[model samples]
Target: MPIRLASRSLPLLLGLLLALPTSLHAQQPTAVIAAEASLESWYDPLEALGTLRADESVTLSATVTDTIAELNFHDGESVEAGQLLVRLSDNEAQADLRAAQALRDERRNTVNRLAQLQSRNLAPRGDLEDAQAQLRQAEAEIQALEARLSDYRIHAPFAGQVGFRDVSVGALVSPGTELVTLDKLDVMKLDFTLPELALGQLEPGLPLTATSAAYPDTRFEGEIDSIGTRVDPVTRSVTVRALLDNTEDRLRPGMLISVVVNRAPRQTLVIPEAALIPEGHRQFVLTLDPADEHRVTRREIRIGARREGEVEVLDGLNEGQLVVAHGTERVRDGQPTRLLGILDETTSVPELLRRGRDEAEASG
Candidate 1:
């Protein structure tokens, strides 16, 4: 009975021994995506959300207290510099102007009469001098009245689009009354803030690109017009202003925009975002030895900004090195690996899974 049991156990042991190599090979980390670290012209742009405003804006107001007699400008109309928009009642001012003009005319006649008498020596010199002084005084009064009358008409201070006015014809308005809004829309000003830690990168004339959700396809180009002199104590940030060309008048004032400033660029080592593996506070990645692609090992890398699906490798990595981008979880230090192909970060997961399946089928 003992000899019969040994024969049965031997066949089972041989069958289990044959399956060991297959199971071990299947468990090895399959590198379906191997990305090479290289020097990429990376953009380390600082980004922030900001508001867009007219390059020049103002609210037109009544300069003097008076009743609005006429509204010359329609709502939302383009106005040129010095174009009349509103007219205040000038009945009393006009009457005073007429009186001044009549007095001036009378004084001029008297002055002419006095000059004629003086030339002929028929009138006293003192009387002629008195008449001339009165004539000059009347002329000054006329000039003053004319200037006061001009104030009744309100003209556009600059070339811009005029907003609607709350007051209409016959409405009583006073100095500083809200009449309308004017905005120069040929160019736009964008104000944004960035952290104080980025002070070193702030400068005038930096190139910027701005976008808005209202016009997603449109990208407005601009540049840094100025930088704030002081940093905000509460936020530890500095304000920056950019000027964007709005000749088309597509950018509206008070609209929010996303800003990206082009910082000083340099070629640096970079890797795919998926290659980074966070282990506690440190990051880990699997790199293959050039001579032995199958010999994979874990390596730590210092990373900076992750933009456009690529990670900026600040340190702990070298250019032209190969790393496992996909199937990273299955990889460990001193593990077996198979280099499939160069897989970009944009590659879909289904494609990677299909590649892994094909490799597994071919190996089997």
Candidate 2:
């Protein structure tokens, strides 16, 4: 049970703290637990709404006007890089290629014949030049035909999940027509916005946790991948981007998620929250003087953040000094008190809080 300092304990504590003439202090020796203040590192984490985006996304389309000859992928199927996706009717391109090949063969023979005749001094230099120009022209035509054939076939640019398609075999598609969509979902880009005030803490590679209503029981882990170059003028918020692994392929693009960023922790002196005795707005704690355990003093303290049932002491205390965490109601300025056994140094913060709570409850 926590020790509750009440009017009854206060009188005894005041006498011990005040040193009340050696006679009075000796008369009322109030034993109290003294625990040393500890230095701990603490951090304040922030949460913001964010979105999931694919590592890569694209709406696949055709570059040439032609009839679709084949559709190689099914809706929602995974595909590999360079995998055939759609094949347009290549009759025209292939025919052009064959014709160019035949023309190139004919031109090559003509050039070889002209070269031999010139070597024999039977053909003029102009004849060989003309034949060579024709061979070059044929080669150029074959290249153009090959390029055109490529437009007739569509290959996956990267490995990804393919979305549904509206085009079917034998359907004619024009340039710029939408065929289907593909997304690289192995890793996702998570984007969120934070107020400009949080900009100071913004940095790359910080740890993050992401959760979504769609998957309430599960949490996804990630890290800040990048930050936006500028903040939104109207909203006064900066955009942050994070990278999350989706190897399990559970997280999808365009999903709404909640992101928690674990910022760097700062060091500070900390003590049990129960140690603070609040008198109106100001707070104070009772501590035994290091030089004399019999003398107790009231120390005013400024607090910062509170966590794990412990409060940060901004001032008026240093680490390793013993403080009266409980039975503070009885302690008064400059009182002399009997020493109780010190709290075990290994006792955890959670255990201390539980003990303090029980003591308060029992006293009530």
Which model scores highest in lDDT? 2
The list of candidate 2 runs beyond 4 A from truth reads 1-41, 267-277, 281-302, 307-310, 313-364
- What does candidate 2's lDDT look like per residue over 14-113, in tens digits? 8787675876544654556677788877767799999999999999888999899889999999999999999999897898899999999999999999
Question: Model 2 Cα RMSD, Å?
Answer: 9.2
| lDDT, candidates in the order shown | 0.85, 0.86
TM-score of 1: 0.64
Which stretches in model 1 have alpha-carbon errors above 4 Å?
1-42, 124-129, 265-306, 310-364
Number of backbone-clashing residue pairs for each candidate, in the order shown: 0, 9
- Per-residue lDDT tens digits for candidate 1, residues 104-184, read 899889888988999999989998899989989988888888888788888888899888767878899888888888889
Compute each candidate's TM-score over C-alphas.
0.64, 0.71
